[model samples]
Target: MVTRTARHGSDDESGDADYGHLQLTALDGWRGFVAEMHTAPNLLPTAVWTGLAEDKRDYYDDDRIDHHSRLLVVQTPTIRQVIASGRRLVQLNRNAHSGRCGLMVSGPAGTGKTTALTQLGKTVEVIHRRRHPHAADDIPLVYITIAPAATPKMIAMEFARFFDLPISRRANITDIADAVCGVSRDARVTLVAVDELHNLNTRTRTRAGADASDTLKYFSERTPATCTYAGTSLERTGLLSGTRGEQIAGRFEHGPHRSVQPGPTMDRAHRRLGRQSATTPAPAWITARARPLPAQAHPRK
Candidate 1:
């Protein structure tokens, strides 16, 4: 499945693709990130021949180095499954009142948990756009991270900030919550991703922690969006401990993540990397091309 020879779409031919970082939590930022996309670059020329200018050859070398450094994301099954499930859940929860289901993605580092989380958001936004082409102002999704040692008001402020709704310094939790819910409803948002949720483990046992959990519960109940929480090893973190934990566990559908194992998936990933290295005439090849040849170097051949 690693098509090293495959060329990407004509859109990428421009080579000015803008997938730059946008303030993902903000409405404009989220839309900007979703609208701008990038895919794998076409395979660079493999052989050095006569007549291709040195500057152009150097350009090819530079392009390959830049892309390889960033690396390509293999579209694994787990990521595809999560994107599909998240899309379905949003539609399923659109009309539900209470007991609306949510998603939980948990694993250790390097598992691509956050990557899958954002891909789901992108998929949801794309589908929404197809359905409502004229609704340019419809935000459809909001993403934010859970701050450590965060209180009830602090939690409310996170959501409010995403909408860029100015919150007065004297505002209460109620004031902020009202603004977030109202703006999200108007934007017709149906999905929300909250990352770094494992940070909540520290606040799980205290009054502030309990209230923080309650604050999230209240928002989920009030907001129509299908919420998703992604973190690392949630079961071990005490995030799902006690009454608050029980509430979250009961409402959320737990999905376990798998690390890459020794198999075709691993083999394919390795092959792709090797193919990329060979195709671009990797750094070693570039250096050899630059250095002088010895007396033994064949000229007649």
Candidate 2:
């Protein structure tokens, strides 16, 4: 009964390239959360939103209607496993007597690494909403990306910006870090997701990069929330190299990384054998033609 919407934009001016919004809906009790990617306004939907008025929907043309508005959730094994691990980390942070814990997800580009973490944040937000339904103030998860050319001070500033804390432009890095940790604790943030952590290890700012790594470690040690980092292959980015990188690595449990696939097998016998394997069932959907029918009827149909 809880939902949070996250908006993202695309560069295409045509608008069709835009993804509507990411949302999370919590199911009954504390069972689980549903993650949805809605279609951008004016964009075609693969399905219609549930409970839409009969008169307002088009029963026939899927491209003419917004199927993405519906309560559709795609729970791939990757997403489910990531969500489970994140949930466990949150619980660990919640019940632990002291210190903190973390998980890291690494993979190549276009591997849905960010998507997994985004869904996990949505679920965490839903849990926070359930607990503080009336307050509407607590943020269960905090998400931030290390900006290009970021330093330890810049990283601290990003947290300050997220919490909307008004701090002096001249505040030292130490002060900013302290402020971020205090706010995170008081807000009861269960998880902190740092995306594009690869940016921290960029070569231009060698000294600053090392400091940035240490800054993240400090955040993990001082904050109550579990920190999850997502980036291109951690090893390739040198994210876990050097003394500070090693320190950061020691604090985190490396979760699954989407492994690069081996080259295609060219064996004709293997291909022939694969073709003989059993077929999978069609996806469950009620439709007219190949397009799924809207849950609600159209007045004309």
Which tens-of-lDDT digit does each residue in 1-301 have in candidate 2? 3343322222433466523332121112112233333443342344654345553443322432334345444555566778899889888778775657788888778767777887788788777777788855566777777877688888888777767688998889888888888878877878888888878764557887877887887887788788888887776666777776686677777765542222263244434434443344433332322555696755575
Residue 34 accuracy (lDDT) in model 2: 33
TM-score of each: 0.74, 0.65
Q: Across residues 68-117, which tens digit of lDDT does each residue of candidate 1 receive?
A: 55454556667777887788788889889878889999988778888889
**Against the correct fold, how does model 1 do in TM-score?**
0.74
Which regions of candidate 2 fall more than 4 Å away from where they truly are?
Answer: 1-73, 97-99, 202-204, 259-301
Clash list (residue pairs), candidate 1: none
Error of 2 at 276 (Å): 17
lDDT of candidates 1 onward, in order: 0.76, 0.66
lDDT against true structure, model 1: 0.76
Q: Candidate 2, overall lDDT?
A: 0.66
